[model samples]
Target chain A: MSMTLEELTDRTGLTVLDHLEQQVRIPVVDGLQAQGDLIVIPLAVLDDVDVPARARWRPVPPSGVELLRGAAGGNPHTLVAEPGAAEWTTEVHDRQRLAVGVLRATRPAYLIHSEHGGSGIAPGTYLVRRQRERSTQRGGQADFLVAD
Target chain B: MRPTSTAGTGRRRSATSGCGPPCTPNPPTGNAERAITGLYALLGRRRPRFHWAASPRQAVDLLDEPPLRLGGPVDPAAPWHVAHQLADAAHRLAGRLDERAGPVGTFWWTTERIVRTRPPADALAAGVSLAELLVVGVRNSLGRSVHDGLRTPLRAALTEAVGEPPGLRWHGQHDAPWVAYHDVRRRLRPGLFHPDDDRQVDLWADIARSCGWWWPREDVCVVTERTGVAHTEALPGALHGEVRTHNRHGPAVGYADGWGGHSWHGTAVPAWVIEEPTVERIGAERNVEVRRCAIERLGWDAYLDQARLTLVAEAADPGNPGCRLQLYDLPQHVWGTPARVLLAVNGSVERDGHRRRYGLSVPADLDDPVAAAGWSYGLSGEQYARLLRRT
Candidate 1:
């Protein structure tokens, strides 16, 4: 009872299996993305089947492509997320997200307090404060002054 | 790419590359060409590695490589990448050195340029100091570190990619803790800044080349040539003319004021604050003493209070650099050019007067932050970062 991807697409909205009841496998496209937990049921036996809109097939980010390279290329071993990676989740958005973030080295900065040494004890937390001050032209920021 | 052993028989790995062209060399002919070709043949030429495959797959192509957004998962400019990069650098640094040298606080900063906004003193009541800076350096309310996923290999690769001359690096156990420094002053010449120039380089860029002096210079201050000499009218005072940018921008060099004075060198910064007393650098020991007395006599609380009313206070006791140095710009930071400065004064009372504006305003870039170039003329973290960019 094998079904064709075209026939399956007609029956269901899913991207159906291209092949059925065979050992052959199809390669994943270069930039195509996998949503959530990916289970490839090769339609060769079933893997190549067409699943409908059950999952979205969108182009992944260049970085994401690298991150999920194996899954995209049908490498079973590499497809598994890194040990502590979060389960894959699909996100739909209206506007593009230009999210920028930075991470600091949190593990307490090493200080020389008894544990390390003493004689050379010199520096401590060198706290640097950065500010954005706009200097005006001509009189230069006459606006910031309190009226005389 | 695989973990290949160097002792291989002429076999090198290769990957599909879409790069427009390959690095070319002089096309040798005749004897020379034959000799080189024969040598390559004898050595067994193998395809070189091309890691950053536009396609996605591995976290990185191979060893000593890093992964960042190129195509999909995240915006190339995501701060997450910055955070991660910092964290990665710190992690690497920690791994390299003895962790027992107390906790190391890696100071990461950046800078940018933009049309200055003459925001009144009241507009920005908040100015940063050491204690407050401590908080900003930490992770936000989110337990995640602020620099959690930022990837800035550029900063790390600075030493490796030397253009003119190799940048000067000062490394040693500062107080037994490993402190490696590479500043701008080492590579650049002084007297590079021309206050008259409009398109000037930011501060930190210059410092990256010299001043391995590590951030806070012992004695550093910028005074605009436009107003260094005392008033042209000798007035009743001595012939010492009065000079003052009045905290304005044009030809005005915001001096970095610190005994252990801090140098602002970065692409961008958050904020910078310089108390009035800080600029008065007479002698090394005297300077430290005066500040100690100033903070003590003025009361630390009063200093904090003036945190907002900067202009008024700076006016009350305008920065006096004795005789103004025609060298107004910060040579260590600005890379021989003046800077787009922002002024945020503590204290209060508002009334727009003469000065126009300097430094970048948030209006240009939606995501860009609004910040001062240091409370005075120094570059903020963001400003410093901007200077680090290649010309």
Candidate 2:
């Protein structure tokens, strides 16, 4: 069943800004979804990424796993799921060096942010990647990760 | 709460509460003077003549001779500098304390690693005790906040405006982290350190709680009052009340002598960046981070129009219906680099019911807006084109 922003926050004890729509049901997407600077793509969509055989996985806790915090350090994009419903691993090899982690869910898991609200993930394995921009300070071809 | 968690909670509470230097302008109390005298007594020296200053800026000016002369040959006959003697004593004391604290084990290392990285809640949930959290909080978190966060930046600014300090200085308030760390250890693990060492730690802790900065010499000591005005904001993800200097309208940290610095989200920047950011000023600024901060202060839309950058290309953003991706050339003089700016709209609506637009710097060679956008996500232009949804 899909959950609203209020329901998700209440379940996880996480909070969002009061301005966000609280009652609307958050969509559970089986495909790709973007939240701020983070993008979640179904594992089947990418050919250059791989999850190794010896990868360690930790079950997503009730309080959720904080995936990324904003540049200034306040807002965080947290991944939440029913206990035992999802497992996450950081041992993924991505050609682009942008993969934050890989998430495998047996049931619907949600990515929640104070500003972006919640984006529900359908039961599936997915690769989460952070965005980057060209770095002008270093004078060469270096990329700076976007924290927001 | 778990019954066993109370001890941890108490330790965590005390550590956070005792974490930072007092920012208010409180003159050093008689207790501070007693502590300094006690420290001198430990070194077999009499109490030095105390010279007080309103601020660190004024304190530097009061020095008749450089407290520390760099790159000089050691003279065996010359009396040891009081500062050096104190440093040596502190090192030896710490060594003895370490012996009592026991060897660093895997558990300690694991907890330290987790404390340094993950959120405090996560570390606690992972079975890290509150006492351990207190240790890391005082050593790492408080150190980062008081020493690295505030003192270092303020020191750099002071050095630029004045020069290298006249002598080796002691951060009176900024020394809270180290002192607090030892104090917490002694309190939590009673009798972990010798009584004499505990007394020494108390002296240092008193000074940290009492003043701003200090300089110690054989016959004289120079002490500065606390900052008259200091502004700070909670570090975004800090688990132990860590804070950094941040003020949009005025100096993030200022003293009574009108000496202070401006910071934008912890980054020390020139006053103009905060006060009068203009396109011309931003173009002339060589530092990339400073320039970016100025541009952000000026807003992207206003900067684009005022800078009048040449439009390179434009395309509709996939999945973000009605939003367009526009590219503009950043002049060599403007950015000091061969790069293009891709202006994209946020996928989510903001609280004000408006979508925010931001610019991403891309390699100059990419002329196609779609390819540039794809490059940001490490995907091919064709691959990103199949995107289905944006929040």
Question: What is the i-RMS of every prediction?
Answer: 25.2, 2.7
lDDT of 1 at B37: 28
> With candidate 1 superimposed using the best TM-score fit, by how many Å does residue B260's alpha carbon deviate from the native?
34
Return the TM-scores of chain A for each candidate in numbered order.
0.16, 0.97
Q: Write the per-residue lDDT of candidate 1 for residues B331-390, one digit (tens) a residue.
A: 112111232212222211113322211122111112212222212212232332222100
Question: What level of docking quality does candidate 2 show?
Answer: acceptable
Inter-residue clash pairs, candidate 2: A73-B236
Residue-wise lDDT of candidate 1 within A1-148, one digit each (tens)? 2232243233323231232211222222111111111111111221212333343433322122112112112321111111222122232121111101100111111101111010110111111111222222222232221110
| lDDT (Cα, tens digit) per residue for candidate 2, span B199-308 | 88888888876666887777777777656565676665566777777777877676655577777767777878878999999988988877876776777677887999
What are the candidates' individual DockQ scores? 0.02, 0.41
Segments of candidate 1 deviating more than 4 angstroms: A1-134, A137-148, B1-20, B25-100, B103-391
